[model samples]
Target: MSEPTRRPPSGAATLRADKTAAIAEAVLDELAEHGYGRLSMEAVAKRAGVGKSALYRRWPSKQRMVIAVVSEPTVALADPPDTGSLRGDVLAALHAVADWLTHPRFSRILPDLIAEAQRDDELRRALALRIGEPRRARMIGVLDRAVERGELPPDLDRELALDLLGGLVYWRVSARGAALEPGYFERAADMALRALDARPRRA
Candidate 1:
């Protein structure tokens, strides 16, 4: 008789991938509802419809899980299209920031996490390292490309430029609760580029 047909190993891998995705969704929900300070693995497991052991299998601690869940989205959203010009790139990057800041779930979770991070040194460090630095680096790369293309001054203060770009969006969308109008991203990019290109006023 011919050998019996054998099942491929894909079943277990697919199940694991589904479970991991479910856990990530649960983490966002838990963070939105409870804030990072109050999030718990048991609660996440319950939310995900998976046992706590599944969580432990994926992450050794609550901190690790939270960092992974939050940072993955943050980094992924930091990516900006080249767009062939500094102005276009700046607008694109600002729009990305605005979108993330104003996202339904993140808009709530981010401010709470920032507040909690102020009191929690470890959490602050993790966020800065995993989310803040990577996002900033990408923005810096945008500026670098502009300089290489002769669109921006080589002596441009890239760090300050990134700050202005990010700070404006954060303040308007996250802090001031201002809604981004149809041309807001374009207008903001124009203003930021003007500021970046402006020469220092001598007394």
Candidate 2:
């Protein structure tokens, strides 16, 4: 008789992934409601409808759990919002990010995450990968599309241009530690466009 077929535990893995996702969402809500200083593992576990041991099996500390929750992948932009020009593209992206940050939960949670990052290298690295790099890449794609269409200078330093565009939003967020006002993104986009499109002034 042939040996019994060996099978991977795909169902178990799927269940674990689903449970982990639930835990992460619960942790995010707790962090948003109570802030990191006051967050409790037991509360998150209870809220997620999982046992404490299960939460502990996945994450050993509140810091790690919070990092995982905050770094969850965001929804992609809808249709890339082409307005037939580079400035329009930049404005669209800025508005998207601004709208995300304007949410009460995100605005409250992000500052706590940044504060945690200052104290924890592992969390900081995770944030850089899950949040920082992806955001930078998306902005770069928008700029590259503009360059390809002759909307922006082909020789423009894309990395610097991305920084010029993204850094302004981060600056306000990090500095003010509050929800951004309307028109803030538009103003930042205007400034970034001027910087990117400026001509060399004749001396």
User: Tell me, what's the RMSD of every candidate?
Assistant: 8.5, 8.8
The sequence of per-residue lDDT tens digits that candidate 1 reaches over residues 1-203 is 11122222244453376678788888888999989888989899999999998888777789878887778777778888899777888889888888888777787778888998899899899999999899899888888888777778889988888889888998998899888889887788789879888422223
lDDT of residue 139 for candidate 1: 83
Shift of residue 18 alpha carbon in model 1, Å: 0.9
List where candidate 1 sits over 4 angstroms from the true fold: 1-15, 198-203
Worst 10 residues of 1 by lDDT: 1-10
Q: What is the overall TM-score of model 1 with all chains considered together?
A: 0.87
TM-score computed on alpha carbons, candidate 2: 0.74
C-alpha positional error of residue 121 in candidate 2 after TM-score superposition, expressed in Å: 1.4
Residue 120 miss distance in model 1 (angstroms): 1.0
Alpha-carbon local distance difference test for all models: 0.81, 0.69
Q: Report the CA-based lDDT of candidate 2 relative to the real structure.
A: 0.69
Q: Provide the TM-score for each candidate, comma-separated.
A: 0.87, 0.74
